[model samples]
Target chain A: MRDEAALMRSARFRAEREQDWIKLEALVAKAERGGVQSLQFAEARDLASFYRQATTSLAIAREISLDKALLEYLEALAARAYLIVYAPQERLGGLIGRFFAASGPQAMRRSALFVAAGFLCMALGGLTGFLLYLESNDWYYVFMPSGLAAGRGPDASTEFLRSVIYDDSPAATGLGAFAAYLFSHNTRIAIFVFGLGVFACLPAILLTFYNGLIFGAFYALHVERGLGWDLGGWLSVHGVTELSAICIACGAGVQLGSAVLFPGQNTRKEALRLAGRDAVKLAIIAALMLFVAALLEGFARQLIQDAGARYLIGWGVGALWLAWFLLGGRSRR
Target chain B: MSLSRTRPTPNRQHRRNRRAARKKAASRVIPPEGVPLELPVASLGVRVAAQLTDLLITFAAAVSILILLSMLFFMYWSTVFALGALLFFFIRVPYYILSELVWNGQTLGKKLMKIKVVAHDGGSLTTHSLVLRNMMKEAEVFLPGTLLLTLDQTAPWAVWASLAWVAMAFAIPLSNPHRMRLGDMLAGTHVIRLPVPILLKDLAIEAPRAISANGQRFTFLPHQLDHYGGFELQTLEKLLRAQENRMSQSSAEQNRQAMTAIVERIRQKIGYADAVEPDDELVFLQAFYSAQRAHLEQRQLFGDRRANKFYADARPRGTG
Candidate 1:
């Protein structure tokens, strides 16, 4: 009687254990059927524990004449459960990382080019305005005020030039400094635009060319006048660095666009991310160049009066800008 | 116990039973794997990238239009080109709208990049969304707005005054959880990475590639099912129902052994001579069944042994 009772009890125990496993399997199937939510942290952890216990129970049940369907079912359940619970988040992380890696550098480079172009365009616009002023009937008055133009009144030109060079007011001095920062910031924006080309390269191109148009229009206004020589001397002092920054920004933008537009072996996102990574430093460098240009514009170009001295300052600044950009400290290209 | 009563009295019916269980499991799992493809999730990076790209592309278009207009004015053709620019305004917006609406939100440029614009729920983009996204182009002026001041002699400091406001307006996207710009939110559209196909046999135990904890149970429908006849399909399905019932009655260990035996029986009946050597019962069962289905399908259809092996080998274990 005891032997029969024990056998029955063991059978019942096995059946009960199987039933619990089945429940666990059903939960997993439900989760898999539902989506990734079926494998949340808590449920996945619970499933993991269930799998361990089930494995041991399964080993014990192996000695008896268990159903084959039950084993197959358990095996499938355990596999799915373990994958959801114990697998590291490497794939997701890797995917995101690759995406950034591919786009980041390219973005930075494009931004640098945009900044350069923006500065060049704007400076050229200023030159254009100067030329237009020269064409006016009171051309000399515009340059040095009425007194200086008359050549017999108080030398207010000296005072005005001095204030422009040395005054601490935001417009006279701070504007130059801010312009330097803007040059760099704009470059960075351009880089961001280009590096995100997987989304489309339109933004970078639009930004780069928009600045170009403004510069063209502004310069056209100046060229319409007769002060082209004076305008050239005034702008070249800062235009070199500013314009280079814009070009660098454009390059960065192109990098981003190409990354997305041509994601060779990588996904579009991955390519863009990689390009963005490379473009960041380029943007910083472009900003720094713009800052240097701002200092020259603030102190040297506006204040200087002797045409010869102005020409010399402009040449020196242009040389330095070219040397640094074309063959700089790092020579990244 | 009920499944046991329903089990075929003949041992030859065991292979048929296992096959049926596999089919039922497969039908449940196939959709999940491809779900990521059909319902793509737009990540923060993608959204940001999309916004930036849109900004650049629009800026380029604006610059081009301005240049074209300027050239027309310079050439004494202001009326013709100014009208052309105005025409572009009408044409450009609709071009983008039509492309996105008809081609799953893929603009020519986006299509080239293999990225597409989609709604938040991963559905098709709407016309309203297209208009909203494009209208945001007005905010994309690249010139430092100094020109606005330079042109507006009445408001000389307007450029400087509005600079801060412009900067602040552009900065809103930085705060968004999804890195969305105003246009993105208003349009209810986002950019997402497209799906790349994954091979079935490749989803094995590499530890790093593991999916859900209950990996074994996540069976998908194998492609081989297209070949089964109505009566054979019915027979296989009935056997699977019997297996599901029998599984409830047995201990886990006893269950594994029985499954292994059943797979072996199926291999023999299906005339899969090499499948008899059972290294891992589940693996053998999957490979053998897939191979048998392929072989049978080919014999009935193509009668080409070599061609059939290629399709059979391509069949993944327990996938839809």
Candidate 2:
């Protein structure tokens, strides 16, 4: 028969080479199932060499081979090898823990200058707003929109103002609903301050300034009404963490902006990606702080009306946060 | 001599002149470092489906809580009210967060839809991005809709402001190449289509038994089978597949020519002495395919790949 010698030649090729292919196949199977570490060093080396040879054979087989089955097998095998060789996605929790414990603080420390800059802008704005509001009560209207101010301007009755600052009662709409709204509002502001840093940090700086302006205008209103002490107690209960979180967020944003504005060696995109990672870590920490701040505001501020007690709680919470950032998760050994 | 040695040199006299000349020419565009050329942005239909699924899920949870809270309120009004406050504020955001976290960037809805959220760097998802993007949904989507629905005589400015925000939310995606939502842009994330592989009918039908008319098959010795590599094998497989479904006469003719040309090229390259009948072309390729595949796979185990066979063999190694 015409196909008899061709069959003999095919049979002979298999007889000679089939053993090694079988060996390599077994090794790959064992490695995939138990991990490549299961192999001894020499065995692992063999796998690598076998992979290269398999890659070559795949090419040669393509040129003239008639076995569709063999080609498919090699194709799948090579893909598995490729995955083991190249893709290195790590466990998500490990990465998250790694970020929080070390990289987050490291990044925060590196952006100290930006933090100072944000604080300065906020402080200046607060001072300006305070000075103007003192000159004329109408300046509160100029600084804060009517909607945001919630008629807390000069026209608001003292009783209404007192209720807002020391409203020991559960929020009319349910404390949770109010807290949720406030948290969402705070989160949105932080994200914008961070995200808009791509525009050369101008928007972030201005937003930080505006935040301080509102704070200053609010403080001035309370001070004018002879309720400045009450407002301080109320704000202090959450302000230590809440305001710091905002400042930290703005700092992170400015850092991201600077990556674009002063990318020295990397392309702007690469610089942004690198800075974005750092900024995101800071934002995560800030978001966590805001959660804690909301907790204090919801429970402590609602229960405590004494100025001394509120101040004590506020300072205590602030100290805990400061210590955590500086010292938590540090290695002893 | 090699072709380059025979070619005439260019006439630029100085390095500066050559540089200037090159500068005068049209610039070639290269992709900036981080951007990848090809990624399939999820279509709007699938995105909407995923979103609706998530909305339904969130709504169900909220309703379940509402029912429970109502029961609790009947039992103890004051205590339940306080508990309700805490739950209402806390539940919604964490639902999104915990799902994304545990699922590794897939919510239950996203899993059902076979899509995933990925950080733009195509790395693991971060808590900050998930939080930021979801919080933005409150500002950009929910809050506006709530205000519009709740207030009968909302300030004209408030209505316009809400409308402008909603417009921005919808408009940003349409304006961009990535079709990214506003939240995605802010968080540097994307909803990507994750295509799970589907099965196909097996192409590996058994090789037929056919006698060569010449009483001989073109015998390819082992060494001669080393001309091509895996890349070529893939090409050959593709060609065979392309011929697999040639039901139409027109396509069948094209396939026949392609098969004939490929067989002839292999015959010439390997110096197979026997003449292969055109009618037996398929059988010839099939026989060669089996032998060559076997030979290549064996070579792979030995660390002797074609194209790089010489380079591999040249590496210094200790005899073990």
Candidate 3:
């Protein structure tokens, strides 16, 4: 007799609640098939209410020790509902606004120390390369790739170097291809530097310093031929943006490496994850900077010839970047 | 209703038990509501297959884009080539990051495979994590992959270095229980197999009948029902559910034989003497299942819960 009562209680429980379960299942299935947006306002509300009810039922089922199958079904339903309902709902427009106005600059500012370290490494590498090139002209061949040198080497005449830097002939037609190539190539290198930072940050530092050596050696070659001022004007127009972007990428990589190496109180994995948040934001902003640099390198540098105007524009952009990082995303008090 | 009752060999039963234990060891994620939910981690094989599907898609997209560009801008082939190269180089990066972002952690391949990435902390999937994880893929997969393609031209030490990197990348996932690659480990994300919701009808409604084709009802006394427990009831329920689904004639024959063996074993254990007709085997099992379930639930109410037939206190009551 007691057995019969227990059986009837369970049956009645299911009979009373099964309809809601079926309804919730249908709503969840629809959402899964055609995203959460497909649901009407009423249906979405219904989904939330049903999800709560299902969770309650799951709790009750555990208390009463209902059959295993019913408990499993309820658990699955509640989990699916939780994931769908709690998913991040910010639209793309809002996300973009938040990224630029807050996350991007704020993340770059937060990692200022690492960025400084990155800058220091590059500067020391530049000094070393400059001194080495001055000591022996053959260091130019070692530091700059022949292809990238493009006939501007220690042996190239000062007039030829000036012509190369101030050349305005290939401005409109071939600049597009040049810009595309530089954007893709430099972005690839930046991403590579960032990714390889996981191996204790040495590789990231080495790559950044190697790039600096190339820059310093090339500049020294022009300084040797008395075309240093012209080359500086030509390169700075884009180098200010491009080199800073690469430094940012290197800093992000170092952040990852340091997180792994010195994972304070948290586990190494957790530290790496926390660091990745800011590092990735820095990486994205760096990529954007690279895009701007690519445009300036391909078009603006070719069109502009005055050394004074070039320095003004390059340093002006640099100052703007500095201001943006320092003050872009501070919350209003 | 006695028949030959051959039990499964102990070794086979042990192996089956181990497999079930492994299946039951799904990871639990606790939601904000304080309820812990079980989510099964995807198998390495399925993850690999999904990755292959994604790679094939990206490769096909890049090749088609190249061909289309070459055809349209034949006169400006140089510019087209550079633009095409940029598109080809960057397509996979955005394809992964944006698809995961827009689809809520599912790429087209992951959706097809019915798997998705979820945060290890049970929070919403963040855009930062998605970007970070996919960025690491450049190091984990593409870098070594490109190196291997140019192995014939590279030095011996470079070949070894690339090979070591490839092996390390492959081994990271295998080393972890969740099968997380380097990116997943760093991003605090893991992939999970989605559950398929199956709604089985209430079994309590299948009360014993008064009459059947055999001209009598199969009834179980209280002592007979006490021979099993809730775990056995669940196993019986699964078998019955499987029987309900349509199957080929050969499998149907095998199912019938399996049911006969089960019926024979129950009779022996409960000492039931009534003869159940061969055609009425399923009816007898169903009647026995509901009765056993009711007995277990009543015991559970009195705080004398029996986990399975193997529970020491749940030994047959004087062999019925």
Backbone clash count for every predicted candidate, in the order shown:
98, 19, 0
What TM-score did chain B of candidate 2 earn?
0.52
Q: What's the residue-level lDDT of A315 in candidate 2?
A: 86
Q: Which lDDT tens digits does candidate 3 get at residues A271-307?
A: 8888888887888778888877887777677677899
Q: What digit string (tens of lDDT, one per residue) describes model 3 on residues B1-320? A: 24677777899989999866765554677677776777888888898888888888987898798787667655365565566555655788889988888888888889889888888888888776787788777778876676566345525754676678778888988876677888898788988888777767766674445346858866778888777767788899888778769999999899889989998999999999987788888878877777777677777777767888877665568864
Cα lDDT tens digits, model 1, A46-68, are 67667676655544443331223
Best by DockQ: 3
Expressed as tens digits, the lDDT of each residue in B22-125 for candidate 2 is 43331111112221212345655787788778877776676678677676555345444444444543566677767775555667787788766666654445
User: lDDT of each structure?
Assistant: 0.46, 0.66, 0.79
Residue-wise lDDT of candidate 2 within A224-273, one digit each (tens)? 99999989998999888888888888888898789889988987656776
Candidate 3, residue B11: lDDT: 100
Say which prediction, candidate 1 or candidate 3, comes out ahead on DockQ: 3
TM-score of each: 0.31, 0.62, 0.85
- Could you give candidate 1's fraction of true interface contacts? 0.00
Cα lDDT tens digits, model 1, B229-264, are 323422333343343354453575676777777766
Query: What DockQ number belongs to candidate 2?
Result: 0.09
